[model samples]
Target: MSIKPENINLNKIFIKYLNEKQYSKLQLHYEKLGKTEKQLPAIIFYYACAITLNPSSNIKNLKHAHNLFEMLYVNNRHDLQLLCNMIELSFRTQEFKVVLPYVEEAYKINQSDERLLLGLSKIHLYLANLKESIKYYKILFKINPKSKINRDEFLTSLNYASGITQEYYLSECKNYLKLLETNKDLEDYNFNFKNLKNNKIKIGFLSSDFKTHPVSFFLKGLLLNFNKDKFEISLISNLHKSHYDNITDELKLLTKNWININSLSDSEATNLLRSFELDILIDLCGFFRGNRFQVISNRAAKIQACWLGYNNTTGIKNMDYLIADHNLIKKEEEKLYSEKVLFLPKIWNAMTPSNILPEIQKNNSIFTYASFNNFHKISDDTIDVWSKILNNSNSQIILKNPMPSSIVGEELKLNLLKKFIARGVEKKKILFINRKKDFQDHLGLYNNVDVALDTFPYPGVTTTFDAVLMGVPVLTMKGHNLNSRCGESININLQMQNFIAENKDDYFNKALSLQKEKNILQNFGKNLREKVLKSSLFDTKDFTKSFEKIIQKIISK
Candidate 1:
């Protein structure tokens, strides 16, 4: 079980490669030591340390590495680090069911360890165990209140697809401000008041989701249609270089001023942005992740606004405006926000789906329901509702999100089936499909779906838009908060007000009714796209014009 005296230095070399993240070097070492009798122990060690950790590892290699890990774990069951590594390896391989035992084993050794706590929280979140995920996050917050990364994760976990109280959400967002002790002395962007009326208003948008995200999808039409002569737009991107793609390049071309603040410190990012001398700065990312709270609180522009990036109010005091529509944020609930509501006339955002969309496919034999939103949004209540719909209608629901192919995917599906089985839904009535990677392929999923059931409290926005675009009717429930009302706004704009439900019971009844109304479904399938195309939601030009006028009005004051 130990290396020979002469080969002891190999262990040090392995540590050096791993510590330095020299994965290639580790791979070379693992390859060099392969299939030798005397080096068998070292080979097994390197398999986990090197092959398992390889970023570009193939499925075969990962499976092999997992097998070696199981062999190693049998004798090293007491080793905490080994258990943690195995847990991580299982994660990489999407074998989430196998990780629980490893996590439990690691927990016995040290419950308060940050890594274990973080891993636990994330896995729970992934599996839609919101209560447990929040429990670990609360524990992490109590352990380290000032940990920015933890706080960001904690904040994101709070805003689930299901709803929370407006007051509670507001309080937590305000508490998020404490993490950034306001550095008010940040150097301000100088304004040329005398020449301002004659110059193009410089508007800067700050966000990490400039790629193929929901934010990017919704912003596409507006970004494309912004009047170049009237507004000088600058994109401040917080996305890392590795994630940059064709969409990023396309977004970059939307404006001449594109800055990457992904790697910079808060002070550095703030100064660089302030250096741009933007007249209006928009916080597209409130607190999801990579949120520059310090910069948001400090000065970087003449006017700062919070928009579609977050579902709730960003508690930054200096955030002057929250871009809204009457459908999104109500006048009575306006008191919950820290900023002035800049209400647009019709809709807050509009979407332009892929120019060449995939043709919708239909299943005539059986009724099919689907949800394409993130798995995190699938609350227990939402699951129960969907189950009821399926049970009543004798239909199936297809979850076309990012579920893996491993035991984790199976377990997640099984976990869902258990919930449905309890509610008297057949396992066969609940279908699970892994998400597609390509945009066309992703949209192609809607072909199998007849009606897309929107998640509650945190209903689908982009997914709702996409389903409507794909000619599938969506059933959504209205909630009090911004996240909950996104579906309501979209449905109203689509002129499909009947699709919007007053409550969970309404949502259920509507879904069953939609399933029963085959003639309506057929007519909807034929005309929904044209309806969306004709609606305000698809009129990018007008949405942009309205957006500009709102900005002009706000800045004029």
Candidate 2:
């Protein structure tokens, strides 16, 4: 190979340096080529990129990189490379708002640009503006119906929406299936079902959240206590390697077959799964992130079902059954889902009981309410009732979430605080807690909480259970659909009907009323942990039996 003058793209050389980890070489080249007007932009862009991409990048260097990108972005408004650098670096320093105007301007310049729309939609979602986020995703889908990423983001956004009726939601789901009909669906696949009453039934669970997540807690009891002799198990984990934790190790200890499909493509993974000869393949991710619905669309096993992780219908008809308990799904509402609703006997979920005491000993006199759910689930309607609860009671509410550390996390808290401020609650009346804690420490913090205030339209499932496990009863408003009614189902299983609120006013009223019965509530909390263990909600053995019976019946068919 001969080096030819004018044959090389300087930009390509810079990228090569980055890809090869030639940081010193890149810096040397930039210094040597310093004063050329044509090479300056490329040099600055790549230099800033290197800083941001470096693992040891600190706050000072990150800010300098952010500034360099901002300068380049100002000169080259239409340069997507520069714009992307600006977008990424700004978020690193928590100055995400700095790039908003540029992003929106770029979108206006080219509304059909997929990257711009993606960045915009993600920005809106992070800002707690789901409506705007959904709107952009819908636009992106309309532009490129064949793009799976676009469709995935669009459908995930729809998961947070509450359609006026179940029919309206089902129609939306049907339309998604209709769109995917054009893709290569494994329609020719057939299942060879044998009489599995004598042999062990092989069940493969697909999920990305088998690690430290809400899904893991809900899935714990089942995986740990399933009739392993009768039902052979395998786990397909779809999460990035960095996300694997102690919980992932725990899940692996339960099953002999652990498939790491994190690096496999959809087709590769599907082909590998088909070779497993699975009798029943249940998708735990549902429509949430890392769902293998596309693989399910191929019918990988004899019987396919979806449960846990997500509450509502996945809208993908390939999922033959949607697992639910009687309390979780009403008989009349079965028609709302595309899949047949498989009703469990008592509860659809059961978690491992914590060994540590559920409640931390709180000596504070101020009454406290808290929700350990994610911040995005807190809608305006949710804040409406919560704010009223704060205004009427002589107490403060503690809101905990998985936010970034130090000042960066504090900024997100302010955004949430402003929402409550608009609804007449002062900042001081609400306290924010960081979610970085040991599992035992996390459970103990529930003791300081007087009542766990569940969010509406999309109530907390695992968090609701977490509260009960910690001797704290969650106050949740009951609603019609599955997403809104999860708390209802969990509470019903525990026979805690008084904890359920019927409507908005009822929710606020119940919150205030519960505050008045502080002593009674605390005494009840002391025994609630014991009650939760005995109830069907935490009874792993009984729940697993019900689960196995359903799986056995399906395979036998």
Candidate 3:
């Protein structure tokens, strides 16, 4: 082929440089050409794009390359692919906040793309605006009802925000279960391939939260105990390397194989897993919509199961099993789930860094009553119950949540005060602190609290653990669903049942009575910390054994 004078002759040179992964050299080539060639805009743009696609490129080059694309892409309407590429780069670099404006702009330009909705929903959920988060999520859900968004975890998250009674929550689950049962599309999700190996079991664990996430807290012990020699462990992760903590590093060392299928298409993810000869695909993500749940509907693994990370039974028919412990799945409650329940020894083993020892409780003039649950956990009923505790006792209720940046701490405080004032509780008794940071420092900051309080309906498991780890006693009300029952489990294990309440009045009475009895609170705090140190909750070794036995049973089939 003859190169015309205006053609720039950049095609072969750019491709050769990209083929060698020489991004900097390609940039030099683009810069050297300047505006001399008519095709310079396209050539330079593609070369910068090639640099951004390189996995080895750091955030600096990705940003610079993206900026270069922006300069070349003069027509804003024709820049969707480049914008999406930039969004992907920003997401990979842990630049979630930076991606928000781009996503919003993209939605403004083209709101119908499923990929854009997916990206938007994920970011909004991260920001903790559940209502606004759900609005975009539902858009994707409507498109792929059997795909990702309408899964069990998303429904449970919505129910949690609804703040209804335990009966209502159960009723919601039962009603949703009906939809899964009758939906012909969900019924079409069966993957009973004859090629399923009897001897070898392929275990695929999928999740976007493998770091210092709430999901990680419970998964640590299980990941450590999963025997690689007996079963092939394949991890499909959307979480980027920057999200890694010490526990995540431990998971990398433990897993037999790890696949970064974060951005793969549904067919691509399914095909990738099938190529691995997967016998069992475990949806650790449940229905949370982090990574490739649409792949789950395809049944990439022969015997699919779900456990740990999400609390509810995934209503997907292709999901054959829902892994839970005896505590979480009673025979009576089995009807509530679509998938057959595989009961483990305990609900799920939680593993925390051993260094987070409980501090000795010291006397303070003002009794510090605090709960570090997310702001969403603070529903109308939860605030009402909390107000009763503060009203009955002449003490301040200190609330810590990562809400102020989304809204503001003072605004949340004002909202809570309004709730309390409506219930005739004094406004001065409520305190609110809202900020966001890495979990280690965030959990460590709870040492300033005296007695930790657990929210009802949608109670906290990880937050409760974080509070207990700081040697603060948690007062809890055990309700119907697993959400409300976490505090009871922790209290039972810690042998601090005095803090367990049966009703709203009882919860208030206990909080009030405990604050009055300082000596009793002190004695309980010391005893509780000692009990926790001796309990299986903190005993990684014992938890690991239980996890191993369960995996053995599953793979032995």
Identify the candidate with maximal TM-score.
2
Name the runs in model 2 displaced over 4 angstroms: 1-24, 31-39, 52-63, 90-94, 162-165, 185-198, 358-360, 402-411, 521-523
Candidate order by TM-score, decreasing, is: 2, 1, 3
Residue lDDT tens for model 2, 431-509: 8887755877777787688889998778888788778887788998877777778889899988999999988998888
Candidate 1 has a TM-score of: 0.87
lDDT of each: 0.77, 0.78, 0.66
Cα deviation of 375 in candidate 2 (Å)?
0.6
RMSD of each: 3.8, 3.8, 8.1
Q: Write the per-residue lDDT of candidate 3 for residues 1-557, one digit (tens) a residue.
A: 75665555567778778888887787777767655245555676677777786677776877776666555543564667666666666544445554577678778877788778877775555444455566787787677665523445456566456444545445545545555445344333454566645454567788888776667667666666656566567667877777667867777777778887776766676777777777677777765557455576677776777876776665566778877666555588777677787765643556655565535545556777888777667666777777777766667777777433533323334545676799987767777665557655665556566778787666777777767766677888866655456677777766677888988888878877777665744565556566666776777777766756665676566
Clashes of each: 2, 2, 1
Error of 1 at 392 (Å): 2.3
> What does the lDDT read for residue 484 in candidate 3?
58
- In candidate 3, clashing pairs total 1
Candidate 3: list runs displaced more than 4 Å: 1-154, 162-201, 228-231, 241-247, 289-291, 356-358, 402-428, 434-444
Give me the overall lDDT of model 1: 0.77
TM-score pick, better of 1 and 3: 1
Q: What order do you get sorting by lDDT, best first?
A: 2, 1, 3
Pairs with steric clashes in candidate 2: 359-447, 360-447
